[model samples]
Target: MQNPAAATSASEFAELPATASHGPLRIEYRWVNETACDAPIAVFLHEGLGSISMWRDWPQALCERLGMRGLVYSRPGYGLSTPRPHDVKWPVDFMTAQARDILPALLDALDIDLPERRSMWLIGHSDGGSITLLYAALHPDALAGAVAIAPHVFVEDISVESIAQTKQLYETTDLRAKLGRYHADVDSAFYGWNDIWLNPAFRDWTITSELAPIRVPLLAVQGHDDNYGTMAQIDTIADCVPHAELVKLDGCGHSPHRDAPQALNEAIAAFVSKQK
Candidate 1:
């Protein structure tokens, strides 16, 4: 509703195939409220290279555990959504675009009006985590709370170097093949994200200043063994928002949902249940 032009950017795919129409992109989302009990909505935001398929069934389990309806979707150029323009690379303000424009448009197309007492809870991982922070900061009242796992608040040399390694793996190994299993068009999703982060302008990306505006309760988690980000990311978040809590997982890497499902799920369930 906010940016009609951005919302309709993917309109050509509207007549394409099987997918949920969120704006012009086809978002794959699963809704399960079998309990018929009134509960809050939990929006699950995937990692940079993640999609609904990559999330597997974790979202469903979390929703059932907490008795909340869940919303999960792939952004444009990912999963079942439309492919991105090949020549277009992600800009330095990519996160800002997602927060100020794309996310709101998606919510509008979904026909969801913000509730008063308990707003939608966000569970975001990695890039989704950063975008969640951005969204929470901009529309603090729209969220009940949020849980971010291994979110990046600032870009570091380690991340860029690691991403470079990943690019090599994508070309030399079966990494792209593995991604193919989860994405309908793995290249679109992969390149759209990978190239943006690797862009020269992306090296200085930081959302800490924006995060200070977040008024909702937050729970941030990071793996001790996470190769993607440093503890400073969550540390900065807690520093910025006094109400934020940080959890450090041991023996875990980037994908905490898969590596430590029980712990992650339990923590999230507890956090969402306690939301007021």
Candidate 2:
């Protein structure tokens, strides 16, 4: 792996054309350790309410430590990317749509050949983590490994309750102002995620059965004190994927990357190194 002291460049944007399922969108992305193109590539997927900027320097820091190239991007409705249409309400299978449609489209636009090049991995957090699992399961041959932090395999009552509280906070607190710094259209980004997760019909969401198809190594990380989800999230991954590994961190919440960057980085680096 490469040392974290290596030089890197600033973040940039790329325009992805419209696909049958998704409209044209601009993606804000950053390349870490660009000089090390020959090394493996790791894609960082942000959480339900996260954006590329919200990840701060962690993605670059982790990529530099692993001596690998990293791709960190905000999904269509987040960060500097395009906003979701006002009339559109995200479907129940929103994450599935991301994994099966948007993600592949974004990668194709970026010219990342997954089928021909197998040295790629996905590091996703929260909703992003679930997307990673779905993608990895659907395209088992395209990736080498995956790391999911605070991912939900099934919706829990706590998850819905916490989301409800967040909705209240967004309305009552400065949370909207704080989130505006990260998203281009805060309402689009927030409602697209919040509405679906808290939807009455979405409470039945579960991806455990879909996980059985994953063939690559997986590292599932969760915080013991996570208010949004419990250890059962990663436990489900381990139960479905025989080669899956779990890391439970204490004194941490839903966002492990933010709550425990040092430990999370080390765990991810070690896991990727072992896979290599």
The best candidate by lDDT is 2
lDDT of 1 by residue, 1-276 (tens): 111222112212222222342235555554544342356777888898987778777877888888776667777777776667687777788777777777676676666676622467888999999988998998887888888999999998878889989999998999999999878888888898889889988888888888888878899999888888888889999999989988888888888898999988888777766764
> Which lDDT tens digits does candidate 2 get at residues 209-229?
999999898999999999999
Q: What is the alpha-carbon lDDT of model 2 when measured against the actual structure?
A: 0.87
Using TM-score, give the best candidate's number: 2
The CA lDDT of each predicted structure is 0.77, 0.87
TM-score of each: 0.88, 0.94
| Deviation from native of the Cα of residue 190 in model 1, angstroms | 0.9
Candidate 1 residue-wise lDDT at 36: 28
Residue 131, candidate 2: alpha-carbon lDDT:
96
Error of 2 at 239 (Å): 1.1
Clashes of 1: 0
Q: Cα RMSD to native, each candidate?
A: 6.2, 2.9
